[model samples]
Target: MAEKKSSALFVCLGNICRSPIAEAVFTHYVKEQNLSEKWIIDSAATADYHTGKSPDRRAIKCMKRHDIPMSHKARPIIAEDFKNFDYIFGMDENNIRDLKRLAPKNSTAKIELLGDYDPEGPCIIRDPYYDDGDEGFEEVYQQCKRCCQAFLNKVS
Candidate 1:
């Protein structure tokens, strides 16, 4: 096998919810497929609002229901991320636009909407904070699983 090549960055506004769940689900799914070594994967926020915080408990609980563990902490996107990650996936358009503002000039990082990978078409995962429920997290988690699976198929 020619060495597989890829690196992915998941992004959201706060990094305390959606993005973290995406990171956990993608990491778990790729590992189970034994393709973890082929790619670099991580997550960050478009805003610093929740920097240094752990994922929201609601999100953690939701992911746990799916048997996915999320031990990763939240961090805001850094200048280096625009250079380091091959792909930067945002939880929604607003996050994507915000991240674009921070991206380096002439950035080659492939910024995208995470849901674009959803077979369901360009739908954004809803934010649960507004409603205080895991329903949103669960929906995003399922989409992340499908997307990551599709990504692996394309890359590996």
Candidate 2:
């Protein structure tokens, strides 16, 4: 018998900050558990503001500080993603709203806030793109780490 594969997509406003952090955190957790083969993880944006761009430099730095490797190009959420992913997780209310608006009528993905899985934190992943310092990026990384761990525990 073979293990079943599950897929998740993380989303945010621009795909260069919060969403990519969540995606990377979750991927790291999965790899650590040796379950990477059983999961398909990715991230996207509700807007195309940074389409094809790398995640924010601050976000990359934060991930590096945590020793988690990340590599992703920004991309807008597409209708097909709604059907392909088993779960579609948004960083905040606005991301959820946009996902809901873009999801196809027949989409099978379970759309919800990524923070909903965080047992010890708020149910909203804040964006750090406009923050004055790296603190915001660090905060985002911490939140994503907790949320991703909890989410993995639930699904695995």
Candidate 3:
């Protein structure tokens, strides 16, 4: 029998920072565990702001520093995403609110905050787009790494 495939979508306000990092971190973890074939992971934005753009440069640098690869372009969360993924994790409260608002009535995905899986504590993954330094991106990377690790452990 074929193995069951689980899917997850990470979401943030613009998709150029936090969400992409989360997606990459989760993907990295799955890959490291040799479970990539069993997982479908991606990232999206709650708004159309950065659609079609690559993740912010700072995010790229932060991910690279940790040896995580990120190649997803920014895209807006669509009603179809609600149907495609088994789980949908938002980076902040606003992203969750927007996702809940946009979720189709018949959608089957479970929506929640990614930070809920963080072992450190349940906290929001704030956007780092406006930050003038790399610190915010670094923090985001750390949070994503911790949450992704914990989430993977739970699902494994």
Candidate 4:
């Protein structure tokens, strides 16, 4: 019989920055390993702000610089996401609190801070939206890359 797919949902306050980067990096890594089909990956926001927007342009540029090809429209987390995804990763403490507050009683997803997976990095993927420049985006990208690698290593 075919096995069930492992699904992940990356989340932040805006969905246009940190979460998207994490989604893109994780997606790129899985694809590189030819394991994309075994997983369902996506990103979302904890709130409605920028709900229908594209990821922040700085985030796009950061991905481009790394040649990761990020392309995701911003979206807020839906009630169903709690049930659909196997893992729901928040970018920071606020995101984690929000996710837990919104999750249904029967939610089966393992909700945790994505940075918790980072072996050698900080346990918070700070928002880069209000930062001075694209430099913050790069930092976020690096954090996501490290966390993604560590999470995947633990899971796989």
lDDT of 2 by residue, 62-154 (tens): 999999999999999999999999999999999999899999999999999989888886998888888989999998898898888999999
Q: lDDT per model, in order?
A: 0.83, 0.93, 0.92, 0.94
Best by lDDT: 4
* Clashes found in each candidate (C-alpha, N, C closer than 3 A): 0, 0, 0, 0
lDDT of 4 by residue, 17-90 (tens): 99999999999999988998899999999998997899998999999999998889989899999999999999
lDDT of 3 at 31: 94
Candidate 2 structure lDDT? 0.93
By lDDT, the candidates rank as 4, 2, 3, 1
What RMSD, rounded to one decimal, does every model reach?
Answer: 2.0, 1.0, 0.9, 0.7
17-121, model 3: which lDDT tens digit per residue? Answer: 999999999999999999999999999998898899999999999988988889999999989999999999998889889999999998999999999988897
> Which number leads on TM-score?
4
TM-score of each: 0.91, 0.97, 0.97, 0.98
Error of 2 at 147 (Å): 0.5
| Pairs of residues at least 3 apart in sequence or in different chains that clash in candidate 2 | none
Better of 1 and 4 by lDDT: 4
What value does the lDDT take at residue 136 in candidate 2?
96
For residue 3, model 4's alpha carbon misses the true position, in angstroms, by 1.6
